[model samples]
Target chain A: MTYCLGIINQLGIVMASDSRTNAGVDYISSYRKMFDLSLPGERSIIICNSGSLSVSQGVLTLLNRDIQNKEEQNLHTLENMYDMARYIGNKSREIQDRDRPWLEKDGIDYSCNFLLGGQIKGEVPQLYLIYPQGNFIQATPETPFLQIGETKYGKPILDRTITYNTPLEDVAKCALLSLDSTMKSNISVGPPINLVMYQADSFEINRKLELRIGAPYIAKIRKLWEESVRHAFESMPEIEWEQETNDSEEDIFID
Target chain B: MTYCLGIINQLGIVMASDSRTNAGVDYISSYRKMFDLSLPGERSIIICNSGSLSVSQGVLTLLNRDIQNKEEQNLHTLENMYDMARYIGNKSREIQDRDRPWLEKDGIDYSCNFLLGGQIKGEVPQLYLIYPQGNFIQATPETPFLQIGETKYGKPILDRTITYNTPLEDVAKCALLSLDSTMKSNISVGPPINLVMYQADSFEINRKLELRIGAPYIAKIRKLWEESVRHAFESMPEIEWEQETNDSEEDIFID
Candidate 1:
């Protein structure tokens, strides 16, 4: 299992992902799930992947090959973020189509998903959730985030805190906390977490981070967030049970 | 979909559940998921269920029939809480086994799960998670809670707040908040929540609640908890970015 999230507000986009992947409990390993497929100045494309490792890796290899071969519809050649998303989705479908039959024979999942978030030269920054079947949905102002895998455990915080007008840095902080919440709740979502913040129209990938296991920054935030949540819970109002005796007393008084 | 939780501490056990069940998004309905089967002064048996509505209802009907007929292995006649769990698990498996073939024809799920928490005479209070396959596991001090259906969203709070020594009222409060969180994150789990708090060795269920949709208490707590969580999230420490310029300056100093 994996958890990847992308949040786009007016200021910029924040993309985050966990690094842990496993074929089974015994065969756990870490791999970078976030890729900065940027052209520095022309177009900035960030892709975060989840699901079957083979399928996602296959899609990435195809994408990099397309770039190396200077294909007509590669990420670097795409004129807009929407086309870039379609290109990635198409590559994903191609890989899944090739592998689905054999993977089915062994009961292996051949599907994968990607979160495409970045800015092209002409378009404003955008975020998309690409499905396993090559379709996608864009994030809007009302719902300014897209998540790919193991999404629910980390969603409540995002639902409560993120908005279209949220600051870039605060969005980054929320994204990290969302990932941390997921990692704490699920063993399969352990980290090293990857995070990237893209400034709208910058067309450059400047602020990026990889917090490996036991990193002090990760520890500090995890500890503080846990404490804060505990404090919040302790502050929740008590349940006010209805008094059955009071109802009987009222009946007796009326009589 | 449903979300039922059971948390047992030294003082007592607190059980709570949401009331929403859906055949599809268009066919959603509300049904109570918590059951009080206590034989006051003899035993206190509370059952909360999740998964296929038909399977759960079938199991419940069978349990009631056995009790009504005074069957030799009925709930009231059971020797201990462990036996009660197995009895419920057996009933669940019986329903699934009988309906699995028909359900399979249409790919409808026939599996269900139950959280059975209570105490019988001469035994300490206990909690058991009965699986669809007639097997169950008990909750211990280290992990004092068991949850079923749409569980992950509500788990982090329980993991952080529940302990063997947590007060009964506090546990009940946490349980309600946990259900509220799940309902907020998922549309399939919603209000008309049911809760019960059973005191250890009392062999009675005195405190029970039904918070219907838009119930004032539910609304108040939901609002308060949302505020508390937002406050907690906002209080989280900021991420400290690594200074890339420092690395370059260090290199220049070495030269």
Candidate 2:
């Protein structure tokens, strides 16, 4: 019911998410799924969530509560990006476990997943996908992106465009286009897109935007991408049907 | 796993499928998924299949046996394209039912789906997607394509390009490209690709091609499409990130 992704390139990390959440067709509503947790000059943490809204809310509440109370093992106390991811994963599992029995009685699923990406004061920038089971995997140079929810429709573009050495601005643009493609194919993932870009080692979140359906920039990106894709398709070489011959039945039949 | 599709256009129907089947990573093999049945000039029926290989083989075996014996309710006895689809669906269901319990005992699935398309004498050209439960749905002018098995990766292009008004050759080209895209993203779907085209009212099967991984025409299309896509992506207008502003906290926070 959501589409969120995080990309790690040489310049830094780019995270994006759609804001639509629905309990059912009639209960559709907009709920922001990206959370920004930055400690001014010390650290910057961005978390993009997908799955049950209740469990996501519970995890976020506990995280913010820990931050406010300055808990011993809060986000602020985490030593590195991996530790931060582990903390988030553990909290997510805790919340899901708390509600699983009651929600299961009503046939509701309480599992949620998160994309945790940011930089700690002493560590290089990193990106991780935290699963509902409290396990996580970090992005590698060979595969520099992680996506959660409604991922297939938006995957081809990312698979073709992104790399570990891609520029920061270009990665951000690709992320937006990926979300735009998903929104077109699936109704469950709607607009009011949230995007954040963290320049490697900056420890500050200055480049962020929220785009709604009618926003001028959003309109420009959608129109340009559509036109470009159409142009690409139009220019493809025509199939040379005349030059090929059909094979005998023996060549094609397995049995 | 397989990727097969049928597109109905003004000129006629275009059907395509990949040739890979795998029970697991180590057991990958090639099995032709497209079968042709033509009474030449009287009827031209093409069937593309996906799912349990054993079930598909069983259904095909029964259909062939009925044809050999000139049974009263064989494929040649079908009155129209819809009737043909129903016949195929019924045979598929019969085969699945026969093996369902035994397969379940081994924790295996005995289900298969089919895309049946072609023309019968005195009937309009048609395409149908037949379910494992022995029910089928025909493609309409508004939504003129049906796909089965590993469909998502190839769907965006079909959504963007194909229509009832598209020319027969173009539709065939689009089907190949769709299969190409699926093969690129999913290892489960691979070459050699099988394509068949039927011109409306012809009541005969004349155009079909089998393309392998290194076939000259396949290589040409892949090169041209990749180049065109890269060019299109490069020409897209760059995003103006500096002009956008982050919204207030209330705009982004769910709580």
Candidate 3:
């Protein structure tokens, strides 16, 4: 299992992913799920994958193969982020078509989801969630972020904190924090995380932060977030039982 | 399609569940996912469910059948909460055995999970997660809670705040807040929520709360929880970027 999120806020795009995979609980391993396809200062593309390892690795191999083939439809050759997304989505469909029946016969699903986001030399940063069936959806201001794999556990923070107006670096921080929240709660999503921040029109991937399992900031965020919840519950109105708190009159808890 | 959790703390027991059912996204319905059988001043039992609505409802029907037949081993007839849990687990397996292959033939999974917690006349408050295979596990101090269905989104809070020492009412409040977080992030879950609390040695089922949609307190909690998350993010350290906070950055960003 892995988790990857890409946010297109006002400042730019922030992408984060965990580097853990498992065939089963006992066969766990680390595998990078975030890949960058860009010529620095010219164009940038980020792909975060989740689902069947073989399928995603297959897709990645195809993308790299396209890059090596000197093809015009390569991630590097796309004129804009949209075309890049379509190319990836189509590639996913191609792989599915190749693998589906065989996988089905084995009672396996060739399912994968991709979050593609970045800028082509002349275009603005954009994010798209590409589904396994060769279709995709763009991220809107209403949902300025896309997450794939083990997304739900990290979604509350994203739903509440991510927006188009958020700063690029803050978006990065929040993205990591959201993943931190998820990793703390689920054993299936362990770490060594790969994080990248893209400043809107630079067409270059900025700093990448690599987080090991015992990273300090990750621990800090997890502890603080839990404290925040406890504090919130403490601040909520206390249960009043059968009567109001200020003028309680024999309103004892029946227990 | 549902989220339900319960924790047994030193102060008491807390259980809460959401009420949402969906047959694909187009055919969503609201069904109460929590049911309780309690003898006030004697004992209290809360059962929360998630998964194939048919399977859960079938299990509930079987429980009710037990109540009616005077022959089936029901919660009321069980000697302890563990026995009741085993009853639920066994019934789940019974339902799965009857429905699994048929659902598999149609490409649907009939597996369901049940979270059962309560106090019986002579036992301490307890909690169990009953799996579809007719097996179960109890919660311990190291893991004083159990969650079923869409659980990942809400688990960090329990991982951080739940302990054998958490007060019963606080446990209930935390459970609702956890559900609120999941409901905010996942549309598959909605409310009217069911909450139940049991005090140790009280053996009573008096502390139960039902939160209908638009209920005042629930609304307050949801509103406040979102605000709290935003505020928490603001309180955290902002990521410092290596890029200049200069005109070129602004110029590049605007394009």
Candidate 4:
């Protein structure tokens, strides 16, 4: 049950994710919950993740072992993007405080959640989210976006088309039509979706992609957003009910 | 928090709901979570409900005190419509087993859930749902809809326009645009929304509605479904990215 997201508009940051991952429903799998901690021209991070894939692979193997032990606050020695979202919320609360009491004696839930986003070589392109209690938030310009998992069937088209001056390829085609309307009403959000984008100061991630389930550009953005949402629900406006029975006959001629 | 629904189709059954209720958020109000119960030409029931408004007003006051003591199985001595959805799932598990052990010794939550739908005289139009454990299910013809509570931000437009032949005024404008996209991404699902419909062999519900929040036909179906979903996200299709950078430079000239 995962459906990651991240937008931050004005020509940068997109991030999206969804690569199934189930411990039940016959142990489904597909992993890659987006990671790519860029560094082409110095700092770019990505992160996505959702919940308990062993606490998002133990917070990405303790954030790639704090950048292969160059620690002292890693994520390539954070200095911006909110200290790399407080160093991935302190390594997702230090791996859910060392495996949440032995995975809650087998009930197993070791919570997870991330998002992150990037840009550092002298800050700017940001975004965040973090929480599984370690705490974080960020994304602004009046909430440019930041979701974690299975977020409300892809939040009403990012609450009616994102903002902060949208456009970075229309927020990567509204984050692949909000992860294809959350993998079409969720089936544990399957797909090889991934996405990424980052163009702000271009620390360079070179517009990523991934897609999968019949990917011809995800079947032409799901057949042009389901034929433009069934031609915008057949050009709405019909419910007149004969002007609601003439406004209930003018409320029975004003009683 | 609530957001009812129903649907069915071939020109009948629609339901819909959402009339916020809260015990927190400083006790918000407004009730009537759709009810009705037609008898015109005998039997048309409706119900709708969601959760714990005191176990849906104690399972609608014990199914209206077993139809005001004319018991011997009430809801007009149910005989079909799955015996009136197993008599409203056995009076919602007999009012959550008579007030769930003093509402779980104060942690409250005496669960509730229902949908029910109509038609009885020689039964045909139906719906059901019912759960909080007394178990119920019905709606078929490959899922003709049935939701309750803040159901997944109005389930991807009833999983992309319901079926069983969808038409009863386009399933009452897709159940008022799926309860206005679950009251625009849920703030505990609000508004005076109601709706109703039922048509089939006209057991008679004669179209109902409630609307409110600037109700001029719910402000013209929320200004024509937000201007036909912002003109269907501005006529989709744009995402060439220079033919995906010449198909990623023909996959780097075939590796």
Off by over 4 Å in 2: A242-255, B240-255
Q: Write the per-residue lDDT of candidate 1 for residues B1-255, one digit (tens) a residue.
A: 999999998898999999899999999999878877767689888889999988898888888778778899998998988889988998998999899999999999888899999999899999999998889999999899999999988987787777898789889989998898898889999988988888998887778788888898888877887787777767767777654332222211110
Give the DockQ (C-alpha) for candidate 3: 0.27
TM-score of 3: 0.87
Of candidate 4 chain B, the 10-residue stretch with the lowest lDDT total is B246-255
Question: By TM-score, who's the top model here?
Answer: 2
What's model 3's lDDT at A98? 89
- Please provide, for model 2 over B1-255, each residue's C-alpha lDDT reduced to its tens digit, 9 standing for 90 to 100: 899999997789999999999999999999899988777778888888999999998888888788878899988887877778878888988887789999999999777889989888888888999988889999999999999999888887787778788888788888988898888788999988999889998876778788887889877777777776666666667665545344435433433
**What TM-score goes with each of the models?**
0.93, 0.94, 0.87, 0.39
TM-score for candidate 4, please give it: 0.39
* Model 1 chain B: ten consecutive residues of lowest lDDT: B246-255
Q: Compose the digit string of candidate 3's lDDT tens values, residues B185-240.
A: 78898988877677778766557677878888888877887788777777776554
Model 2 chain B lDDT-worst window of ten: B246-255
Q: A14-128, model 2: which lDDT tens digit per residue?
A: 9999999988888899988998877758998888999988898889988888987889999888887888888898899888878999999999878788999998888888999
Against the reference, the lDDT scores of all candidates come to: 0.85, 0.84, 0.79, 0.78
Instruction: Judging by lDDT against the true structure, name the best candidate.
Output: 1
